[model samples]
Target: MNPKKPPVPVPLLMVIGIVAISFSSIFIKWSSAPVSVQGMYRLLFTSLLMLPFARPYSGAACALRLKDWLLLGASGVMLALHFLLWMGSLNYTSVASSTMIMALEPLFIMLGAYILYKERNSASAILGMAIAIFGVVFIGWGDIGLSAENLKGDMLSVGGTVAVAAHLLIGQKLVARMPSYLYSLIVFISAAIVFAVYNLVTSTPFFNYPAREWGIFVLLAVVPTVFGHILFNWLLQYASATTVSMNILGEPVGASILAFLLLGEQLSGLQWAGGVLVMAGLGVYLYSGRRKALKLQDSLPNAS
Candidate 1:
């Protein structure tokens, strides 16, 4: 008899992560609180929940240079900006549009890397960029004709995309030095502090939120912020990053479906088309980068 097949952990974890993270937008929509209140507390609660676990790895993080810490801090602030804008966008647009915009993150990361790290872009990369830009323009154009509020929401979502792409790219630099756990902890703490101070000055009234809103806050912390991210991070050890990234493209589908079933949200034809184009462009962009990397690796002579 053949031995029992081993369990597939990477894809399993990825599916679970996708399902868990799909609730982030749903939870945010369920809340009636202001953006500042939701954004600050989400980070604050996630940070507090992660603190105990991060302690074990904090010592390992000390080996990181000051530049690494600075980068992590910047990433944290960028994360705050993403939450501020993306979470707010849900109020103005359908879940499908917002989640579809989130998938454009890879394209934004390409731009951020070009500007911040001065990374060279391939011809395919440029082509992919053009396509993605056109898709966004198409989406926004349709939104403008339909409702200016939608156009505003799309723009805000795009802004949030840029922020998150910057956060991921910056964190990429630091993760080479320290563990992801510690890096996540520092960034979460820094983001929480930034949001907290902003909220305090703005008087966002974090404590007076209803109990149901508080439960949503906790769900945001545990589901997407902690569990989903941690699962993806862990799966990285078993699967190629490329595979993991491709799987992340499914997030919009999962989220959109949940929105449809649970929130009774629907998307326009333009939004659906834009989502397809954005995802196609991103897939091409990532594939091109991989090809370039492979070609470079092949050109390097074997070591003596």
Candidate 2:
């Protein structure tokens, strides 16, 4: 018989994730290194930190196959490409438009899962996702713009969102069996290696950055990269990709508050309303999922 899984506190971990990732944008703004440089260092530091506890790297006997490692590598490549494309859009599109487009990630995950794996959502879950998305529109309502010139950037943002969704989807399969830190270490190392090669090919210097910038890189690694993102990776063992993605929608709310405290970025009245809606939607949706899961568990004995 399979061992019973440990109870993971999904809500709490997701809250931690939101707060952790909220610092990501701030770190990027604070860094002076090129995007590739900053990304490489962030992964490098994160992978190093996670290395000590990572089961895959600990020389323990594991069930990992060649295909498994390749899937992890693919997931890492997709994540790297998501960053490159999303950031690349900034040159040609408004930040608001990009944010809005990137926000489509949850939908992509849901749809992709349905198509590729026949995963389905409950009525309440679908409702929750829609409401959360509406809240995002309110938060970004003022920033969104449309123009002929933004086509390429808009497309890139959409593509980036899809790539990120795929990353999450890939993780859903393996997160159950792999040690959390081990999975994160592998993916982080993979991304770092990819970025390093890309930077090297393009002649981007990897060293001698300003101390202030390096500090920001370390913060980025600790905050968003590890606590924020890898925490999500860890949480996947207990939640569906769609649900996890929904939880991530909380980031804009947390990020806005962080920005106000750290960078003096203020939220408009509509954005505040949007934040409320996001929290409410997530609460309702997650509650629904919990109820359903409990119901299924209760039925298992009778069914057997």
Candidate 3:
């Protein structure tokens, strides 16, 4: 018999990982701190918390190429900006709208991969992305007409999505050349420094937050930033980027459910339908991409 296949399906692991990541938005919304402070502390504590676990310097004596270092730094900066925009969006928009719009990052990733890396995009992948975009449009329609605040939030959410896609593309390039933990450490540290400086320059009062807000901030750092992000990165070792992207479809579902339960946010019929379309599109994209990856792997020569 062929050697036993890996126990867990990659797609399933990715779904679980993304589900954990989905909790992030809810925590951000629940925290009483300002968005910039929330972003700042989340990055700060996550970097600090992960240091003991990653112990990245154990292997840092082997210097990274300048290009690799630049890529890693860029990824961190992009991530910082992504959080700044995404968390800020929550302050102005419905969590549902922000989550749904951010779900489009996968589509942006696909487009970026095709354009920048010349990765082949199958027709099915294009179709799936288009369907998902349509779904996002449908979800945003009501909010589009509602108020300027919602519209501004929607724009910020979209900007965050673009930044996240850029992060993924950069990550795909960098992770291949460095340890995942090391790359994560570099990115987190860089982001933390940037946020810290921004917090200081703006004279944001960090220590003035109420105990409850601080508690939530600490929980946010531990749960979503540490547990969720590290798990997602670890899963990348076993799963293709496209597979992970597919799993991200669950984020909106998880976030929406949490919002409804915790904040009593009601979802309209059109929004639910749109969510289904997004899920279906992601499903199709993953299926097609995984098959392609398997084929490519099979065609490669095996090491003796």
Candidate 4:
């Protein structure tokens, strides 16, 4: 008798992971700490939590060349910047605005893949991108009445989205040749170092945070940074990037609900409509891509 293979449902895990990550904004908003300090503590706790799984020295062994190290380091820097910018945007704009803008990351990723990696972009993907952008615009309009401050926040969120997209694309390359956990370890350590230096330069007191703030920081690190990212990386082993990317549309909806229940923040009817559009667009894109990929696979020659 053949041995049975344990079932691992990747899509379900990815959904749960992303929903957990969506709560990160709520935690950040709940804590009364400075954004820089919050970012520092978040990275510190995440690095520590990841240490057991990553085993830095052994992970470092997986990087066989200077180019690999450079790519990993770049991804880490981009990730740190993404956090910094996204968190900072929260200070200037509503969480709804920030999250909706950040939801544009899939569009950036699609564009980046096309430009950088020469990946082919189909009409369905382009239409999906446009629809997603419209949804973001709708959400943004509902957040702050199109004021300058809100516009600034929207731009910052967009910048963060670009940074994250770059990190993902580069990270995909690194993970393809090395262990995912190892690559993640290097990225986290690098992000920690960068944020530490940034905190030092800006005179941010890292050690003086209140206990409650520390608790929230630890929660953010453990829940979103570590577990969320680990599950996402794991899903990549079973699913395509497009499939995973489309699932990210769930984040804003989750965040909005948490913000409403926890922080008493309310979303407008327009914003809800925007969220629906985002989900619909992403659904169409992912479904179309999967069909295309399956057709291609079916047509490929197989070995006897």
The estimated TM-scores of all candidates read 0.77, 0.89, 0.89, 0.89
Please state every model's RMSD to the true fold in angstroms. Answer: 5.7, 2.7, 3.3, 3.7
Evaluation by lDDT, superior candidate among 1 and 4: 4
| lDDT minimum window of 10 residues, candidate 1 | 1-10
lDDT (Cα, tens digit) per residue for candidate 3, span 208-276: 778888888888888777666666665555554444555556677678768888888887777777778
Question: Which is superior by lDDT, 1 or 2?
Answer: 2
Give the alpha carbon lDDT tens digit for every residue of 1-304 in model 2. 1123436567878888888876776666556678788788888998888767665456532678888899889988988877767656655664444555676688999998898779888898888878888887888676555666588878887887888899988888767567666777787888889999999899999888788998988998999888878888877766778777876678777766766677676668888898788888888889987887788778888996
The list of candidate 4 runs beyond 4 A from truth reads 1-7, 55-63, 238-243, 301-304
In candidate 1, what are the lDDT values of residues 241-265, reduced to their tens digit? 3333444455676677688789987
Residue 214 of model 1 has an lDDT of 90
**Which lDDT values do the candidates have, in the order given?**
0.70, 0.77, 0.75, 0.75
Global lDDT for candidate 4?
A: 0.75
Give the clashing pairs for model 3. none
lDDT of 1 at 172: 60
Give the count of colliding residue pairs in each prediction: 0, 0, 0, 0
